[model samples]
Target: MKRLSLAILGAAALSAGSAIAVQATAIEVTVVNDTAVLETRMPRALSDYGFFTDAAGQIPSANVTPYRLNTPLYTDSASKLRFAYVPKGKQAVADGEGLLKFPVGSALIKTFAYGEGEDRRLIETRVLLHRADGWLALPYKWNDEQTEAKLALVGARLDVDTPEHGTISYRVPNKNQCKQCHSIDDTVVPIGPKARNLSSDWMAAMVKAGHVDAMPQGTGALPVWEHRQEADLNDTARAYLDVNCAHCHQPQGKASNSGLDLRWEQDDPTSVGIRKRPVAAGRGSGGLNFSIVPGDSSRSIMVHRMGSDNPGVAMPELGKTTVDKDGVDVITRWIDAMPEKTF
Candidate 1:
């Protein structure tokens, strides 16, 4: 990405006995943005779209703005730096507690990194482009030198040492897998940027900037993940499940056949995986009876599958190779906190 910055200055003079001159800074730096490149073509390099100011994809252009979700999806605990860009003169429409309906030519950029401070390394950057046809997802792998990132159309796997799971083979999902996670009723859609999950501060800023049409009804409806311990138990656990598992577990998702709906709005206890027997007899479980047994997590099949790393048995089956102890702990506590119904 070639970003050029030019400083322009001007001087104004006023008529007086002795003419006085005042200098003013006209403009700072003009951002290089080619909206046409974003709408068409699948270039070999991520920089071809001209989204970032630098080759590392750290500095965004003027049109791009960074954003974060209150509760994010956990993908092997990768530190996801999210950003969004909309074509000038176009604003995203706020859906009812759902995803912001971004217009065509909008782009969602996410860079997945690992490690802390100086040791940090960006493994990949995923882009979701809103084309005239539909949303398309692409993965670009970063180089060892931490420079430019190239599109990995087929995806890649590399062994890396992680803070949580030690040295494990990390899978950068292929284009088809991206379609799988984003698929909603056979149409690819974004899972993040939901109105309820956005922070109030971000909502206000986006509104003020005119990027978003207006503040949605339920901004910050989900508890912040960092301060989740201080929030309501049920709400926090459900939020985690919504971000992490609900994409596939909901009725319109790929895992609809399983009959467990973990969406935050789902109120029914049975639908939310309590006292509900497996739709499929075994369901790749260890002969567990219910998805969640009130006041007992060990017997709950949800917890059982979540805590496992087995290929055919893990709950999510994608995004995570090892277990999320904190997530599992929260769900476990939530289940344990439930009072068993007395017959």
Candidate 2:
């Protein structure tokens, strides 16, 4: 009887070990590109790429790093969670103060959310895949259950409650519309992830982790949005414009024809919209002459269009459907502080 009991105990221990092994296997993470999916048809579901460890929790899997921009693009004040997934054996390269060049088969994931604390709900996740041919932009809309995000080729509109604006129609840009803000020189390129716009600490850590090849030089610091009051006014305002408008206003961008270069590196006052005239005359110009009029925020075309609710008059024709009061306030403060000048 004692011998029989010992054998049963040993069998139980073996079963427990087997269970432990299975649990460990279940928790192992996998994060990398799906080359076949990238090179071929777009994946119908975001889960098909295996980017997240927990979709509901917004947790990224192994090799996927979460990062934040010093000053992010304001999309109706939506909270954004961003991640970069660089494949094994490949690393991202810093390109001056411009965007980091991700190797082929890498991907960028961004989830836009709304609400506060426990009530926060994810609205959409936009992915930019770096394929052998070029970058591909795809937007995914999260389900009401928050379990999965499915491909939204044509995009969707939903009424979302925002802190600044009450319930408003939030836009999830279609694949084509995604190309508009992301495109530069007719090529879809990432506007964010510029070394200058990123935290120096974050960059250093990435280098230490061997995920990035080198720490970029000449990356002038962009002010932290949360700590902008403590930072220089010029730095704060320029950083905001660079992240929000420069992608489209730069010479290589879709709005290149407008001749307004709001890039952080653009030192020219005229290019930065100090008494610069609008390229065309229309209601979009708000009957104002210059894009920015120093010392006169009220008369500045930038402020008028930015403050306008009219679709035709709003500065950013896409991505924004409501007026950005906080953004307008920042620009207004900058313009108001500028010494009065005339063209």
Query: Of the candidates shown, which would achieve the greatest lDDT relative to the real structure?
Result: 2
Give candidate 2 regions above 4 Å deviation. 1-28
lDDT of 2: 0.83
List, residue by residue over 1-343, the lDDT tens digit for candidate 1.
2122221121121222232122111111334344534555776777777676543536566567789999888888889889888777889998879899998888888999998867888999988888888888888999899888899989899887788788888888888888788889978889999999999999899889889999998988999999988999989999999999988899999899999999999999899989988886365567899999999998999999998888788878877777888899999999999999820
Q: What is the per-residue lDDT of model 2 for residues 157-216, given as tens digits with 9 covering 90 to 100? A: 999888778899999999999999999888898878889888888888888877789998
Each model's lDDT: 0.81, 0.83
